[model samples]
Target chain A: MESRALGTGLNLLAFSPAILIYVYTFPYFYANINLAVLVLIAVLPVVKLLVPKRYSSSVYPVALIIAMLLVIATLFYLINPSRYYYLEIFSIPLALSTFFAIDFAFAFIFIFEGLLSKRSSRMIGYLFLSLGTMLYELSIIAAMHEFSLTFMNALSLVFSLEILSYYELFVYGYQKFLPMANFQIQINQELLVLFIISTIAIVFSIYLRENGHQRERLGDLAYSLFAGSIMGTLLFAVYDYFSYTQYQLSIIGFGVLATFVAISRTSRKEKNRKPKIK
Target chain B: MIRKTGYIVLGIIAGGLLESLFIGYDYYIVALMILFFVAASDIISFNTGLSRSIRNVEVRREIESNSARKFQMRPIRIFFTNRTRKTVYFHYYDTLSDVFNTEGDFQGYIILKPGEQTKREYSIASIAIGKYKVGPVIIYAEDPMKLCISSYTAPVIDEMIVSPALSDIYTQRSERLSNMKFTYGIHYSQKIGQGYNFYGIRPYNESDDTKYIAWSRYGILNGEDIYIKQMEEERQIDVFFVVDYGIGMNQGTRQKRMYDFVIATVMNASYSIVKNHDGVGYIINSSKYDYFIPAKKSQEPIRKFEQTISEIRPNGDFSIFQTFSRIKRDVKKNALVFVITPFSYPESFRKGTRKEFETNKKVSLFILDPYDFMEKRKDDVYSALMKNSGLKHYRYLTALSKFFNSIGIKSSVSREKDLLYRIMAAYRYGKLTNEGA
Candidate 1:
């Protein structure tokens, strides 16, 4: 049994490179929709089902899908080095995707670096700030209609990507550093409405490509979108209500004020009595 | 509020930089909208946050029962209120008992306008036993544009208890075993009568019976005194102890002390059984967690058994019959079985719960009641009612002991700490009775 297990291990070692090569090439042979769906299905199963239960719990499957995108992006660069100057801007998408794909690694590394008092990721945050600027700049000067449309769509996609990064920063900063400041912020209804509206626009633009029909029927999807928005917004409202209302304002305020007046009164009494003591 | 405004300005600056890179001269509109959104959202969130801070927010956690042991899941309820005029928004993040080793992700927002209350309910999977501290509910809120996020951690603490596994270990009728000598020989009759070993005999006194005499010694002593070798016959006896590591045991700031006390009792009992050279074993039945090691002597197999005991963490779900069936396979010989558990779950810890406990074999059963000893004894009327309930449960245990005794199984009951003292009391009484005889 031991020998057979060892042989199987060796076989897996030999086949790993073959599997990597197939993963890189397979997506190219298929259309983007088919490729994306296929990658999603395959990656989800391998990470979720085939792996041991404990390891599966620790490793988020989202990271693998992101990694696959990074591999594809790297392969694209390798295949077309001559077009590097024209396509250098596309690297922003690749860089952001890599961060998403390897989030577990990034989380661990950040935790370690934070322990060591190194602020390298803060620098990366600044770099993302810079690249986001550059992408916005490129979106305007694109000469063709298709080019501008693609650029605008891509920028919107980047906006959605910022959700995870910002959320991570908020949690990390709140947990480690700004603990005393009571940093719980509630989600507002207006923000939820905005998110739903923006999501609908992106979905209609990407999925429902009938330009005139989509433009005319965009309002149809608004109510359901708003309904979805309220679910999260409602939870945020309660938290905000409790934190600000309960102890911080009324009870605490009156208590402090009463204490202050009493202290001042006692001090005045003491002053009046000081001559008698002398 | 100022911090929020600064972030909004920074966001606008970022948008402008993007605008310059993309539309160059014509990128002003998008930059302006992003700036406007950030500024408006921050202002709204800051004012709302400040206003809501003045209102009363009530957070609560409701467990199914204050007293529960391993294998039982606890339900948590959170209530949020907005007592102020302006509407408030917030998100809830719950942390569970440490045994779970993972934080639950339940981030969602609620909007509570003034004089309105919102509630959320979630069930947490209970994995381990001990006193579990339930909540200091943390709420995260941020301005609408995601510029500034604030989180307020609650300052409330709640606790729950998880019980331990029970073993069905009943010993047969035996002498009272005690550590010290007693004036009254209550336990002497039980152990004084017999054993398999032969000791040196003494000359027959006036009370010596003619039945226990040696003819040759009678002849050598000229019929004045007869001597016979004293022989001891072995008589099998049963004992029982029931241990509970239930939720009530899970009170107090430190959970380890309760758990340690229960474990120490089991170990000491097992050690006594081995030293006594009797067929001794114990049963650990708990409603909170499933762990049962049958009574067995200390030897090679017991090393593995000890390892199993060491590895057990307090858990809340247990099946007694299933555990018995598993432990049955390990015991091949006729030996005593001692039960140590908190009989909490009615369905699981009742009379029909374990077939092994009812088996018509030469097994002795003992139950050590942990709850009776560990749970806080209250003096109020409600506490008096609870105490009465405890007493009723004790009567039930004693009745169960009588049933086992009728079936040729020696059964006894004691608090965890008094187990060794009881055994020692029994042994001492037996010795004095033998000397008198």
Candidate 2:
């Protein structure tokens, strides 16, 4: 009970910045992903308590959708619909850079907590995910030339406060589902997910449909697809810094590089474990 | 091998393909970072020795008793210890055969933190009679992503026999026997001897040891021929079981077979006869295994009877006629021959069996039908037809029994459950009437 009360108190403390951001960016209040994240932090820890027992299974997804919609609608009630994207309404490149840099620095700690210790904390994973997302946002922003710092201070503060609130929420929310975490893994979820990615590889395989008529072999097509994905291990770190999201060649280049190294390492371990015949 | 991790690796490759498609959107890098994160998770965990830990997880099973009675429930306990420094969350499964029905969970996810030891328990009942094997505990570890798994099949297996409750069956047999009518205390056999009960008179023969000449008979004979009084000689009856061990005898489900009940009948009757100090013997013949024990009034034959039934896998061809022919020679004169069979034999079997043992006036034939001992068939047209055919077959066997009885051989056509009562009654009736012979 004490921990839950502390969690709710910390959550509200972090959520107070959203009210300030609303007031500071008033009259032309611009919506942003960080603002949506603020709404995400406000909603999750409270949904289970408010929702009735009968519809308990649908409560989390419903809360997430409601939070996203409310943040977007409230922030940009008077804005033009034509320019809705990941970038800020008063886009500032340096502020964006600092945000991503902090994320990149935190990601190493996240990896240590999850991978090395083998007790992958979900809160840390979400924090690392936020930084990778920051990297994603920076790539697009660098492509566009016009930049400003009009609403940077307010937005940056809101994002920092959003991160704090998320920590409080994730810690509290995940504990309730810790016993159910293994059960949450639908035994066939991996199969369906793998199928979708395999379909993408098949569609992008140039070797298979080379020049419409001259067919290349499946082995070669597979070779190119995998060779491309492996090139992706160092693919994201550089691709984002160059703002390659706006580049013409970046698609064919980076797409081929990251074909698949995930299957590569795990598959090797499996083969090593198999018993050899005498 | 059972928890195939190879498919999971294929799953991760598919994620990589989705990452490639994300190049159309700037978010493709986000997908790439996730793939990279999972790959590193797998590699680093392997390096940190989780793989070694999973292989070292130990499982041990302890069963209370090696043998259980049919329809009797027994508890099983399994101990698991995580010897590794890292915690493991793995699926624990204990494989059981179809004959066993478990009362508690046999497979589920279990958590064992570093150096933690725990035990799980479940109860199982064997619904049928036979020996059954259980276990070879399989535990497989997977990270939350399930990208890789380390499985260990523990080298643990135990076997137990599910036979009819022996003590209960004997107890029921004892209760049923005390109420049975005896045929004259059985120690006094009315034959011409110098024992107890008087027999009329016979002319004195060279081999006769005359304790006293009958004076009344001498007066009647007027000294023309010497006469001696005869007394009944004391004797006991010996029973030999001629059992069928053919493929035909093994009808019904794997658990409750026709031959299983036949063995029950033979065991009960043999026990009763042996208890009364009458020598009991048996002959079980088939192409696969042939065994015959001659009449002996002791506890040893009863023990052998049980051991053989438990071990015998009833298979191969058996001819009741041939077994009876063998019995005719193996059994002693005037000893009762008890034949238990499940075959709906041809006309020749009846003729041949009667020719072999009926003239000796000491044979009892029991024809057991499997359908009478097994569970009923399903409620469908095909089963209805089969049940009809079974009825006709049973009537034919009963008619055959009547023919054998008409010719002076004590015969019964029924199921294994009823054979015990019939065999016991036949033995007692044989003892009661043997005085005339």
Candidate 3:
């Protein structure tokens, strides 16, 4: 409890400057990619360090994303050397360098805690770290535009899915091992479909933005699509929680419709199979 | 194939319905493009010369590599051969077993060019112990139109056995401390100054040299000569552990609860006792005497001890008393006993366990509380119970602790809160005083 309170307080205090900066420079964020990336790369590790070390798996993807971003920036520089006159040749790369180093250090500690340590609290801490790392990596992709973006987006989508699957597994595991309470959530085929659609949409949005002529608009659209879908899902979850709404009603409806179709088709088959009574 | 088509159809329907609602034909156009692309790909993929050859393509791999021990990673190489003329893109899929849960970076597609023999190495670590089969390597070949996709499943599956890691006995603490005093013997032997009892002995044989000669008997019998037999002052303490191996015990992560903990505890105890020259540990579960190595004052015997514990399986009902009863007959001499369990049984059952425990007060029972090793965060039930009107949850600790106390078995509780620390603390307490209290 003390650690949590301290972490929250630290984050609040540390975030004040960033919040103030963003408030003063809201609309100019799109044009100031260099500044935004610098600020993000600088502040993320601080915020992460402040966020009480629970999520371990988050560090790897975050580091990988940072590395990929540097590579993208280098490619950008090579593609348009004269256009880069206004920007520092090594600024983005330097920021990314620090980002990788910091993320790696944190990840090493978290992974060690997860794998070697016998403490359950530490393991839980590592899980949270992993969750945070995924979010961080997503934010970075939301900021960048390049051909590699498609692959990164696909990876991030898969990573998020993996995290959710792992979370469900952990919850089930807790129930199975401790018998404290049952996990009520039953992930059905519809949810799987939804997941696939969301992932595909996200991947396509990224791919089109990077490879197509309208690359400039692609980044923002992709971000909005991701944000919108997640928000929609969150809204559903919140509504369900507060109203005790049975989301399963829709699933049941699907099942019943499926059954109706099956029976009707089966009777038709039976009709076809029967010899006409002469 | 049906699942894939259903997705494409659902996308089309959803797009078409939305297009109908809106006046623009853009949604319909997008929907049509998606459908056309999918259909086209399916047809092309199905008829492509590459995919046609893949239909009857038998891809076989003669795998030869060392499989890892349970919980450790090892690399295995697979040699693949495409027995057909055309190229096939193969992707391996396995019915993931409970034991294989390690994360590796090799689930993507691999394209095998025609008549090519390729070898790929992948590492697998088994989280649990059991037999596991690998592969129904799916080969996907599609035509240029990206139309019908054809895939083939390989007929052969490879099997691998994963064993557990073990430690050697000479390295055990007990034998090292004893300085090799007690030698390994198959049967019970009467050694002088080693036991409390004395038995008759009359031998002037070559085997019974001056080192073991009975001076008093020789003195009494005069020149004709004979020797007397005396019992050793102390003998090894034979420890027997009866582990629970029911379905209930398999509820936790990595399946078996008692099995994993027992292995760890047994290894630790065997290490400690074999270090203390006078102690020897033996384990029995089910009806089988799984490990019966009498303690020797040498480290070599500890290897056998470890291997036995590593091979322990979860079988039979969890009857603590039954296991104890069996142990009593097999263990001829006094030995310190340790019982590791997660007590979820009723008071009557515990009472019976206590009765068996009292039969040997020297027993040191370690109740490895399952809640400690495997914990779940539930609503605050204890506070609810105190609140009288709030929600309540089942707290297994308070009741379990009371039961242990009632039975006079020194019990320690381990929780997920600080499991290793708690265990270490309990072990320290155990070492501080032989009594659990």
Top model number, DockQ: 2
| Residue A210 miss distance in model 2 (angstroms) | 40
Over the stretch B251-364, how does candidate 1's per-residue lDDT look in tens digits?
233333444455555544544444454333444445544444444444332333344444454446445455455445544443334444444455545554334554433333
Docking class of 3: incorrect
DockQ of each: 0.01, 0.03, 0.01
Off by over 4 Å in 3: A1-278, B4-7, B10-72, B93-105, B125-232, B245-261, B279-281, B284-305, B308-317, B329-334, B344-362, B375-437
Question: Residue B284 CA error for candidate 3 (Å)?
Answer: 4.7
Collision pairs in model 2: A228-A256, A228-A257, A228-A259, A229-A258, A229-A259, A229-A260, A232-A257
Please give, for residues B91-164, the per-residue lDDT of candidate 2 as tens digits: 78898877688887678777788899998998888765556678877776553333345666677887767666
Q: Name the weakest run of 10 consecutive residues (lDDT summed) in model 2 chain B.
A: B1-10
**Top candidate when judged by lDDT against the true structure:** 2
| Residue B97 in candidate 2, Cα distance off native in Å | 4.3
Q: What lDDT does the true structure give each of the candidates?
A: 0.42, 0.54, 0.43
Clashes, model 3: 46
